[model samples]
Target: MSVFPIRFLTLAVIAFHSNSFAASGQEQQLFLLIRQLDTLDTLVQSTPRFEAPESNARYRFDYPRLTQDIQHIRQGVKDYLSPSRAQPRDPNELVGDYRLDAAHAEPWP
Candidate 1:
């Protein structure tokens, strides 16, 4: 019956909706980039190979350029998809109890 709960519920709902929208936008952007890559693959496959001098040079250049472009795109995608790393811990913090004495610890009988 308190107003605090109602306010908290409203804020929670707003945050949820905002997160959903942001996630959907990111998904759509990724989908578009994938589609673009698919189209590039199709174009690369459909192009005809040539035995002539000029065509050969162009073809050679095209492949390397295509490879570089694909690498750049893949790196971009990886950067976008990868999660952030955890923050580093302080070295001064003790992880666990390090008891040196054998008698003080529990002995296995």
Candidate 2:
């Protein structure tokens, strides 16, 4: 029998092993991301409660909503890292627009 078959088999095994190693490294990085997300959630919670000065600006930052969105992201990541089953993806999307129309205040100058 020709040695070509044996050489091909060895190469295939090496390729498979390399792919597995790469996947393992990627998973580790994702796990680290989950930890960082936890830290971010803590920081968001610790933020002091205060109201912004009223203004006629068209839009204002919605901090509370933003915090909610962050928590949503954290949960999504956690689920991805440890899914219970192949469940359907969430239908709702992130309300990335953190700006809310300023309460009807004095008109712009």
Candidate 3:
């Protein structure tokens, strides 16, 4: 019954739990998106098919709102799954500026 084995087991359990929590969050987000899409489909089906000018105009107006809502939800899912960067550049690629001297350059030397 060594302490080393206990510590290793504890760390492994913690790592597994953290991974499972993150995965569950992702699953919930996906479920919400699917629910939204289903609702939108139902709305489209239940709405009256219009031929009058006024009704057609109202339908056109509603189109953009629905489109924006879908776009927003998609972007939310994308951000949740792959969070946006605070800064554009990768930190690992940052190097001190060192300009090469070309005054004494030779071609392919």
Ranked candidates, highest lDDT first: 2, 1, 3
lDDT of each: 0.42, 0.55, 0.41
Give the runs in model 3 whose Cα sits over 4 Å from its true position: 1-26, 31-35, 38-61, 87-109
Best by lDDT: 2
Question: Per-residue alpha-carbon lDDT of model 3 for 1-109, expressed as tens digits?
Answer: 1233224333433443354445677566465554655565445444444322332232222332333444554455555556676534323321222222334222220
On TM-score, the stronger of 1 and 3 is 1
Which pairs of residues collide in model 2? none
| Decreasing TM-score order of the candidates | 2, 1, 3
Q: Measured by TM-score, how close is model 1 to the native structure?
A: 0.39
Error of 3 at 28 (Å): 3.6
RMSD of each: 26.4, 17.8, 24.7
Candidate 1, pairs of clashing residues:
none
How many residue pairs clash in all the candidates, one count each?
Answer: 0, 0, 0
* For model 2, the run of ten residues with the poorest summed lDDT: 1-10
